[model samples]
Target: MQPVEGSDKAEILKNAAAHVAKAASSGSKIIVLPEYFNSPFGSQYLPEYAETLLPSPPKQDEAPTFYALSTIAAENKVYLIGGSIPEFNPQTKKHYNTSLIFDPEGNLLAAYRKAHLFDVDIPGRVTYYESEYLDSGNKLGLVDLPDYGKIAVAICYDIRFPELATIATRKGAFALIYPSAFPIATGSIHWRLLAQARALDNQLYVVLCGPARDTRGTLVAWGHSLVVDPMAQVVVEAEEKETIVEWELDPNEIEGTRKSIPVSAQRRFDIYPDVSAGTIQFEDPKLEEP
Candidate 1:
């Protein structure tokens, strides 16, 4: 979706619901939104737009976006991966960039705060620090969807870490979903590369959903939302505009890819330690019924 202007939170959500409805009408069982779907994507704006998303069904006044997402998912009867949002913890008085997942019944299944915050300083290029405003999420983002199996969820910068993807693969995730808002500088250079690398490394589907370009906004996002297959192939991609790209993923693809390469079966755990062997935190799929 396009970048939202100041005080347009309601409008942003309305458009998001419309998009989800359209996709669901076309037989999309699971839908994804971009990061910062209801607000602008910049560190400076985090505090201004952050909302409390706790206590299951958050008070409608305090967290309208949360309610809106639940309604959208339940009404459409589709699993919704709400893109990352600016979450404000009232008790701790800290902020987090978080993503919430809802089932077809509108139950809030999981919430994943971004584990890896984007903090980079390029001499003459891009310079930003998410740590300045937001706290890092410590837990892994894995949720099991009925019938379709499990999927790993992560924010933008988390995609750069292969261990998360690998762990998800070992834990039986068929796809890794990343809701991102990449600026033109680094995004133009590393967006697709990282997607392909993660998919190839784990032999799982990699899906990237990003906001469309907004020249009028403070930061211009590199809006090439794409899906990389298990073979590390870019099957479908969106340009730098507000559009939807939908494709059906086949489990056979994952099975066929692994059989052809057999890297997953041939991994030398004796030579190198398996990173996924250790204990990791995972979200319970039966969390917070509606």
Candidate 2:
């Protein structure tokens, strides 16, 4: 979708819901939106756009986006990885770039705040600081998808870190989903490379849902939402436009790829400690709705 002005939060959500509905009607079981789907994609809009999502079942008045997402998921009978939103933590008095997951029943499954902040300066091309307005999250974005295997969630900058994807794969995630809004500078170079690297490294699927490129907007997102298969192949991709990308993922593809390569059973953990090892708590898969 094109970037909206700061005051167009309501319009943004409306457009997002319409797109989601269209995808669901087209037989999409799992849907994902792009980053900043309910607001503009810049630090200047974070203050007015931020909304509280904690205390689960947040008041509709407080977080209209939250309710809207939940309603759509339930109405469509699909799992929804709503793209990142500006979150205002009332207790800490800090803001965060957070992604929310909803089950088919409209229950809030998990909320993953962006762990890595995008603070970079390219000198001539681009310079922006996310830490100045948003705080990083400490937890990993791992969640189970009912009968299907587990899937991971991460925001734009989080995709740059391989550790997060590795950890999620080690914990049994079949696919990794990232809601990204990459600028033209980095997106043109590292966007596709990073997604392919993560999928090839883990022998799993990598799904990237990026906002549509908006030349008129201050922050022009490099829209090219894509999906990489377990074989590190670009199966389906969209151009730089407001397009709905729908693809079916097969669990057998992941299993077959791993069997052919056999990397999971041949890890050299004795040489270097596994990054996913240690005392860690993963979400209980049995807790998923049957």
Candidate 3:
């Protein structure tokens, strides 16, 4: 893993490509990078970092992270999840916290914008208000692969919501990947627990990739990146330092677990009164039309 420093787009892309090349040489078929591996954090510089949608080439002065990711995927003949990047939306003229996936052939397979923005006031001590900078995504993201089966993606804060994972599972995702930059305070308390709980509850593999420690000291993130199996067993975990973790996932286990528990088929939605409750309430009819 490359511990990216500063927001120099070219340098970060070069480092990431080198890491992916090294891993590919070592026989890794799939690689996942940490969240915002392409850009710097904080809401201040988001406008400058956002990338346009696919088929529309990124600006010449833009960082090479996205292009490098696609090239690496094609060159290494490996599946690459381009972690989370700041993406520009043509319609809204705003940026989004987004994740994109590429196939071995360099085809854009899937993309996801963070649905749950990280907006919280940490008891008057520290606060992270992501909603102020990012626009939330409305749809869940899933991609299908012949070898890995169906894989779902969720960004950092999305892990806190089980409904997102549930929706992914309902979409036939056998594995879930989370690219996060969880702060030290919350990560220390809930990171591993949330990953384990999501895996066990969904009976699917969960892979988490987190950024290395930040020296800024203000929003330092915990770096316990890990991969958990369907039974909530840890396959590989990274220490506090920069690291790369690789593991072979078995799809047969997903089939077996679902057959054994059959929880998906046994869901008692009929008995749940609030299952159909409207979550989005609008104050006016104009607000309801989009």
Q: Which 10-residue span in candidate 1 carries the lowest summed lDDT? A: 281-290
Candidate 2 error regions (>4 Å): 1-7, 281-290
- Top candidate, metric TM-score: 1
Please provide, for model 2 over 1-290, each residue's C-alpha lDDT reduced to its tens digit, 9 standing for 90 to 100. 22233348888877777887888888888999888888877777888888876665576788998888889899989899988888887766779888888899998888887889999999878999888877887778899888687899999889889988999999999999999999999899998999999999999999999888777677888888999999999998888978888788998999899999999899999898899988765433222210
| Model 1: per-residue Cα lDDT over 48-101, one tens digit each | 788876665577888888889999999999999999889886665678888889
TM-score of 2: 0.93
Clashing pairs in 1: none
TM-score of 1: 0.95
What is the C-alpha local distance difference test score of candidate 1?
Answer: 0.86
Provide the RMSD of all predictions against the true structure, rounded to 1 decimal: 2.3, 3.2, 5.1
Q: Between prediction 1 and prediction 2, which has the larger lDDT?
A: 1
Writing each residue's lDDT as its tens digit, candidate 3 over 1-290 gives 52544577778787888888888999988788888877776677678777765434455445356667889999999999888888766677777787878889877677777889998887844588887768888766677876767788889899989877876776678888999888787888888999999998899999989877776745777887899998888878887777677787888887888898888788787886432244532111010111
Instruction: Evaluate residue 221 in candidate 1 and report its C-alpha lDDT on the 0 to 100 scale.
Output: 88
TM-score of every model versus the real structure: 0.95, 0.93, 0.87
